[model samples]
Target: MSIDGNLLTLSQWLSPAFPVGAFTYSHGLEAAIEAGWVHDVVSLQNWLETVLDQGSGRSDAIWIRSAMSDDANLSDLDTLARAYLPAAERLREAERQGAAFVKTVNAVWYTSFPDLLLPLAVGAAAQRQRMDGDAVVALYLNAFIGNLVSAAQRLMPLGQTPAQQVVSAMTPLCLRLTVATRGASPDDLWSNAFLSDIAAMKHETLQPRLFQS
Candidate 1:
């Protein structure tokens, strides 16, 4: 596809309108907020950057890279992605969104790759549809970050403009990571956001929760 066409495709796939149930999960941001680790815009931005660089987001980027490549061992990758989730809510968030994304893309995009993990499914679909690999990674990361930020907005005193500003500020980092992970393999999938992982585990018991995780 032309560059414009590819950009349009990514916009559609990553749009909030995509029926992926992404709004239902916070990726542990709620718990972080509850714990006061992410109470304001600066803290939220830092938290999201950590996720994008060293947390599950980075791992998912690697998975997406594998899925978009010809040598992807999808079943094994799926298992790894599943086992890599640090907590139950995180696991549920991935699986539910993965299933929804797989169903929607298969029906709409007209291919039937197994409805596996979210990152893998999206990577497979991007490859099947011949979307630009870097664009796929960048767009996917942005969507993931955007969803979490939206959840934060609902769960805290964050305003719309600042939430979007955080996203905008993270764009360069997103593109840089997309480039960095371009040659990544499934074996490289790992995360180091210990605080986020802990938050996800704690979110299971967090009271008065507005998000699933």
Candidate 2:
């Protein structure tokens, strides 16, 4: 495929219209809202930046790059990815979205992705399709952050303009994280967004919730 072709494929796969059911998960933003940790655009951006920099976002990027490599351990990587998810709902979020992504890719593109975590599945597919590894990481991170931003929008009275502004402002951080972690292996994967993890775990028990996790 040409560069344009790869870019188009990445755009389509990462778009919200893709059947990953990503909107159903908050990545723990709901619990944060309940705790008053994120109520407006500034706070939301701050929380999301932390997640992007030190949470599953960074860890997933590392896994994606590793999986795209020639000799990735899909099985071991799968186990580690599952263990890396701190909460039960977090694990479910990754597994369910990953399964959906694999199913869609295999059905539509005739691709064969191992039944793995979301990041790993994406990495495997991108590798098979000959997509640029850095581009894959960047687009995946954007999608991840966009989903959480959408979640925040629904959870609060945040307006569309501010929400979009936040997303636009995050572009540099996303690109920087992608470049910084481009060469990372699974051994380098670690998460420091403990508050986000706890929010996700607590989300499992929140009543009248709009999201699954």
Candidate 3:
């Protein structure tokens, strides 16, 4: 594929219009909001930045690089991703979305690699489509962060203006994360967001939840 083609594919994957159901999972943002850790726009923004920096931005990006480089043991990576998810609901959410992404990509394109976790599938698809690793990483991070922001907007009373601001604020973080993940290894894929994980676990039993995790 040409560079333009790769970029276009990345755009499609990053778009909210994609049918992978990424918008359904808040990655614990909903639970956080419900717990009052994120009540307003500023707090929400801070919470999201922390998540990006400490959790998904670092861990997922590391996994993405590993998947793209073919340095990841698929079974081990899958197991770790599953086990690392502290909540059953969160685990199911990732697997379900990952499966959906795999199926959708396979239906549209031919690839030897399937059964990838969400980040792995995205990185592999980006590589197969000939996207540069940096661009691929950036797109994945952007999409992930954007989806969370959208979820926040729904879960909270955040207006469009604040949501857009949140998205804008995340751009540099995504770039930095992409750079940091460029040569990251599977061993680097770890997170310390215990509270987020606990909240997700608790969310499984929370009454009247707005998100799947």
In model 2, the runs with Cα more than 4 Å from the true position are 1-3
Model 1 bad stretches (over 4 Å): 1-3
Q: Whose lDDT is greatest here?
A: 2
Query: Which pairs, if any, clash in model 3?
Result: none
TM-scores of the candidates in the order shown: 0.95, 0.97, 0.93
lDDT for every model?
0.88, 0.91, 0.80
Greater-lDDT candidate between 1 and 2? 2
lDDT of 1 at 29: 89
The regions of model 3 sitting more than 4 angstroms off are 1-3, 70-72
- Candidate 1 lDDT by residue in tens digits, 174-200: 999999997998667678899999999
Candidate 2 lDDT tens digits, 1-213: 445789999999999999999999998999999999998888999999999998988998998998899888788889988887899999999999999999999999987766788999999999899899989999899999989999998899888899899999889999998899977997787788999999999999999899998
